[model samples]
Target: MAISITQFASDSNLLNTPLWDKQSEILEEFWAGNYAIAVWALGRRSGKTLMSAIVATYCATMLADEYKRHLRPGEKFYIISVANTIDQAKIALQGVKDLINGSPILKPLIVRETTDTLELRNGAVFRALTASSRSGRGMACPLLIFDELAHAVDTEAGNAAGSSLYQALSPSVAQFGKIGKILLLSSPWIQSGIFWDLYKQAASGNFAHMQVVQAPTWEVNTTISAEFLEQEKARDPELFKVEYGAQFTGNIAAFIDNQLVDAAINSDRGLLPPLNKFNGTYYLALDPAKGGRDAYTACIVHYDGELVVVDQFHQFAPTWGDGKKTQVAVSLVEDWILEQHKAYGFASVVLDQYNSSSTIQRLSGRVKIRELTWTASSKTEAYSKLRELFNGGSIELYPHPKANGQIKNLTVTYRPNGTWGVSGGTGAAVDDYPSALAGAVLMATNRINKQQIIPAKSYRTW
Candidate 1:
């Protein structure tokens, strides 16, 4: 484990190479460190690929030797590697090939040939893969390397490329105590991608013995000027930060303005009224799904200015033929309303009226149903009002664990025209959470202004 710089270069045949500068020094330290996970965010043309190839060769040789000494007949040693795309995988393999071809001591390892993989002489294998096309359910590797970690997109299944790739290596490493190593190298692109998630986790002590080295484009290569970077930022501010500055920024095209949303969230104060005041008036707001797995059936409970998110129900409904599912959904809503009506005596249940009119008709007798329509103007107005209410500290939330999780996952981004929208990746909104919260605020504030309130009439003597 105490790998010296001279040993690494002599064994790998990279002593006289162009990458044997200060950058290689950092990589050498990383390789010899005791960290379980090491992240190297190298800049453009800073010889990152070459350094990675050298590291891969070193690991392959070391793991192969270890396997030989402790050989079980059926034991498999794997060097699992990943890239962003097929072409990138090929490029990574080319680096591995370069190291193999350069080193006189390690040149005989080439045993197989393909577009994206190389089989070694000592029964060990180097498998190149793209993050998007990864199916790592059965893969078990003692050594795992993820190249260009920042380019992977966020998926609905929670494990973005980095997480998924790591999950695949977990089983293999679990058996080999203190022998497994994971390497992650990338030029930072988006702030909220797989790289950022892993970095955050590693930073927050979720992962043991993790080392992070951030090599900015300028620091790694002096040719990358500040003026040139500024021009790139002017063209596309979001892309520039990720590409050159090596910063992790959430979705640049984010729907909601993060600053506005952050301003609205009152972390200091708990729910507006204490949790004991459960007898107040309450109403449910629903945002029905459009179709497919993309959308979710969201529901929220409104009690005064405090928005208590009760549940978020999501199901993929392909066939809307007779709308039987819609009716069933409405029936369930009716039952919930009746139960709540017996307790809080809600004035009226409000719902987005875009796609659920028939469902509304089905529940006419059981409760007072109000169909809420949102126009482009109205939507803008409502969002503006919600922003104001949030900034003004008028909104309160019940400290429910599920609600807190959703809120933590909530992210906002500004549009090109300076408008805002809300979104989440691991915690994206599927149902009426955002809309219902907006609706509750609007109903409390706007109902009085619009004169849409239905007052309890007095039965006077005729």
Candidate 2:
């Protein structure tokens, strides 16, 4: 007797509850025989792993039945699950194992079971593997499920292993005069990599060979509480978009969550006034363009006893001209800072490590300028701290269209070693504002309540 997926899942622990309507839709799509590829950009806790496991196990078991009855001898088939790490792979493997175990009629067919693979009486196997160059090879499998693909690291064991594995499986998937399927399931991340590319291609209807299903957390996982989604929204709006809304953030991974940036933007204030008479310590940070071609931006932050607000944001042209011309650009920046110092007392000036040495040399005695070289690790740290400040609602932003654009352009990248890198989005016109803001955030943590604000001076030394 042929056991249907419905029979195996009926009254079982795995499907004891009613299937979410969206899950039914996905299962129907998989069995529709219309699409060769399925791309799932679903939110967290949407039961992606569970759904994938059911389909993988059912297909492997059912296909083994076909091979046993009608296929030629010595032929092998497989259903393989691929994840970015061994731990992640275990998730898929565990789900499959549980479903196979919970089914009353399906348990007897398993001839052998290892930590990562299961072999049936027939020459069929169900395996879970990682996204390493050495993994997922030599398997002439029919179906492959990629779990949480956005975080798949490159340069692991040399080269892009995920891409390599895809090439290896593609031929087999299209062989045997039978249609094969590939499933890509993940949460949203930055707008890069295979996940984004394939999704866009499919959605555009440009690739008839691909199919996509994009759903928010609530739409797919009907069991989840609205309160949980609300909490995530409150915690970080940009994060909520990725986790619940299932939307691509931007070009690069946004380091500071969008909700934080949104919360900080003060719509009441347009561009900050040229100067202010506020009685707070002010810190100015400069990220200058190497030449006048790029943007040279300075951001000033005011710290009262308990609150921090961006009081002034300015962008200068790229480093301009020869010695004299360069000096003029320098004079413009220096003069502006000095004047702001008079309007609102500035305690210390923070300089980007790669900023102009000439300008620093010229302003040494006028104000305390500390230059900290920004490395990958240092930039990660500063951005992380800035994110923390925004998460806690500790920083306020004065509304300026350019500043808003720059802040939103901030992207974060993760290394295989688990370190983070923050930068502006690809092809951004200006990153200076965000860079300077990050520096100011780092300096703000060191400011003291009793610290002196450098008062307006009577004499000019420069």
Taking all chains together, each candidate's TM-score versus the true structure is 0.50, 0.63
Per-residue lDDT of candidate 2, residues 201-283 (tens digit): 87898877677889998999888898988877765565678778988766446667676688888878765553455534677
* Residue 86, model 2: Cα distance from true site in angstroms: 3.2
Clashing pairs in 2: 238-259, 253-412, 291-318, 291-319, 292-318, 292-319
Q: List the residue pairs that clash in candidate 1.
A: 191-248, 191-249, 255-421, 256-413, 256-421, 256-422, 298-431, 298-432
Tens-digit lDDT string for candidate 1 (1-462) = 666543665543543344545566676676566677887766655667777776777777865666545446655566767776778888888878777777776676678867777778787777787776655445556667888776654355432545665565556554445667778888765555557777777767666678777766777776667787665655444445556666665554543334544544455654332133544445455666544233434343444444432322222233434543332345555566567556655445666655667756666666666677776555555555555554444455444444444444545553211233555454233323566666655554555355552321111121
Off by over 4 Å in 1: 1-7, 10-22, 69-71, 74-76, 133-140, 154-162, 191-193, 205-208, 223-234, 252-462
In the order shown, the candidates' Cα RMSDs to the true structure are 16.2, 8.2
**Model 1: lowest-lDDT 10 consecutive positions:** 453-462
